[model samples]
Target: MLKGHDFLITVKAPGKLYIAGEYAVVETGFPAILVALNQFVTVTVKESGDYGSIYSQQYRENSLLWKREGNHMVFDNRDNPFHYILSAIKLTETYAQEIGKKMKCYHLRIDSDLDSPDGKKYGLGSSAAVTVATVKALCHFYNLPMTKSRLFKLAAIAHLDIQGNGSLGDIAASVYGGWIAYNSFDRNWLKKARHRYSLTALIDRKWPQLNVELLTPPKELSLLIGWTGSPASTSHLVDAVGLKKAEQVKNYQKFLHDSRACLKRMIKGFQTKSLATIKEEIRRNRKLLQSLGVLSDVQIETPLLHALCETAEKFGGASKTSGAGGGDCGIVLINDSSNTQALLANWKEVGIEPLDLHVHRVND
Candidate 1:
């Protein structure tokens, strides 16, 4: 049930995904197209008490409510998701001043349900969805008079502020939902310094309506979704890439460039929308990721993942890392669910487990 103050917006933030082409976007300065996943971070806002307060469920798990005064407005950190929501709100408040929508204090209860709670691979970017949703709600709450595109740009900038060096791909995909050619680096945006180097010369561009499917593994899908059990820290990993960037600029950028090309090839191949072509492209992209540091030999393609692919050969599709590959839950795309019973039992025979997921795209 979605409640509102006559203009309340009910929005579901989609999950972030890197289907292909990473590390390359960092320096070689290529474009990467990301898509929004089906699972989401849902938010619902209703009129709170008198002061217009925000009630966050996760924050209540820690403590009830947190209130503080800022340079311009009195803000409250009601919960984890709303905390980021407040950051976006504050920024919007400033932007509103630019036009003429003066905003005062208001109490709003923010409801959030983002945990994989039982600890499944719900993936990151779920909170990012909430951040996006919260920002949209705030825009409506105050009649901020901002367009969706304006709100998206503000949300990306705000997400970076919250994550402390966010790549901006996740937020972009979450907001846009489909496919886009996104590159985080631009000498134009990177620095005010004018460079003779033009982004046009080195880049090849195209925008295609992507066809993504939620692959349902067979009943006995020989799938082993091993949790490296250790979540990699995004900041440290980005720092490591940065440190290496200065030393191995040419080699690293080349890998990313090649990877970006591989992604383009895959997206182009999808024009025919053939399963065989998609699998081959995925294999090529896996090799490219392995060549780059994003997907390592051992970590990205674990013995379990490899063996699972081999076993899934009977069912026959492909497998690869769905995101930054330092031991996150990777995906195995199956051909058809025909032999589901036998295939899934085989997964149990080995040590791998399956996840309850579908590779779905967003509705227009």
Candidate 2:
């Protein structure tokens, strides 16, 4: 018989922002810079009466019941808002079973600050954060000694299972925290491996092919995040961009070459504390994105996004739409924070909400 009440465990993971090398990160498998924002998704697990239940404060779901079927965990409700959570629980439970451990029944409460006060997701990688947090909480609850790398791989697998695409850069930032320079692992290789081995089997072994490096931003640099009040579907945008690339293969390849070079310079700028180099790379990046938008006839950047960048530029800052960025959050990198108020005021006047976010770590 399992104990009805035992212990409570909570885990929090930070959201992420892709600072540079967005579209190309998926295609070229090059290094993409990502920062873990202070915004976090938190999961708390505690003992329950009978079966387990979940309450998602972010999604406003009162109570959701989940059960274990053989070696797998399954959500009792379909079309629920806890896709990531459900997937995470299933994976964690499976891992525990494979390692000859049993998990007790418990209630989990999930919440997030990645949304606005009114509950609008601000394009922060909330899904990835939630996945990481859930896995961490599960491991903690079951007394599993999962290393950070193993946790990352589990979270990445859950994330990939849902979205079916992505470079897992967001997952890396959430798992490792702080800032990271991530080179995309070969999706083809991962696909083949997944078919050949179980997730637990893969976690037991190390893959020399995975590449993730930490990068420190310049001390003089200030990063400001601004929400556009409009949401963009990253998958849709990525798919559209992919279609455009297929249509204009040669041009897209040339653009990728330039973007790759620009990202390298941007990385170097961070290391050397060269603000001018960073700004130039950012400018080239936006120009290339704009060129892609024009060629594909897609909405890469909105009018307000451009206006925010221009306003920031007036204050000796460089801004660009971060991530898939038709309308979501834009990143503003400032060398001089002397006039941050002015830049923020200009952005506010144009209906952009400047989010107060910064680099964050899991344990800090």
Candidate 3:
């Protein structure tokens, strides 16, 4: 039973990223920090007219066929949009039931600016972003509360609904917004715990949040981001690392322990503006990634990325790949702005595409 006329609603959701803390989070059960960028997905909800539907500009392009039964938005097709929207609606429904009210029904137009211009999955969490946006829109439409944790839970549902095994870090980053320290090994997430922490507390309380975040902003770096043009799987690399742990237990343990110490120091260095110490950490971290088998010899020395790193070195900066790097985007943290153009031109010489990322708060 429904009564009121249609109402339009819109909600914005940000993009996902990693600023500091990666695999460490999953292992040590610490928070992996990330910066949510301006890249976002917007969901437009329209009250059901004679007909109802949903469309995504950048993702879930198939305008889902729909039928509005009073206040219910019924699905006519199945896909990412179907499951994600339903998950949001379901949560809203639960809330409505608890409050003894009917949730609003509106046609949804969901879209994004994060899709690869070429329609490829760039290993970024585009779907996760969409899921978060959908959850936010539905929460707004139904006048349901939106807490970072509850929102993350919805996104996780959407993600798990689509791809069974989801990355909690990416979801947490998008839901919380801004820089986040995510370690999947964080006992909290593994234990299904959702305790939250702030970058202010994680970083030096003295570290300037605004300035530190600006480092990974949406600007295109003078560096190059290559796709490796191959869909390299992290599973195999991860397995190899795991297998080596028991076989060469002593060596691998030492490597991990050393790397963890280096990362801790690096986190401190980042706080103190100690670039000198930071450089040592990156060098040691890369070596440790090598030891853990996260980086392959072919990857680190690839002529394209290697050349790019070499070029950045000459310009007083460093470059490396992001994520579980069998093949993924490479990032260059260059200190020299004057040489960016030439550096980019040189990278273009090798067919690596430059990717721009907007960095900001991960949550409200």
Provide the TM-score for each candidate, comma-separated: 0.72, 0.90, 0.70
Q: Tens digit of lDDT per residue, candidate 1, span 1-364?
A: 1236544455566766665665555442565656565666655555444466666654455433333556555333322355577777766665666556655656544544434554433344655677777776666666665554555666765665565554566666776665455656443442232133222211112212212232322233232233333344444455556666667767776776677677666665555555566567667777776665643222445566566556655667566665565544555545554566676677668765554544335443
Would you list the C-alpha lDDT of every candidate in the order shown? Answer: 0.55, 0.81, 0.55
List ranges where model 3 is wrong by over 4 Å: 1-6, 49-52, 57-101, 160-167, 185-256, 294-307, 336-338
The residue-by-residue lDDT of candidate 3 on 137-173, one tens digit each, is 7666676655665666556545554443334576776
Compare the candidates by lDDT and give the number of the best one.
Answer: 2
TM-score-best of 2 and 3? 2
Of 1 and 2, the candidate ranking higher by TM-score: 2
Q: What's model 1's lDDT at 222?
A: 32
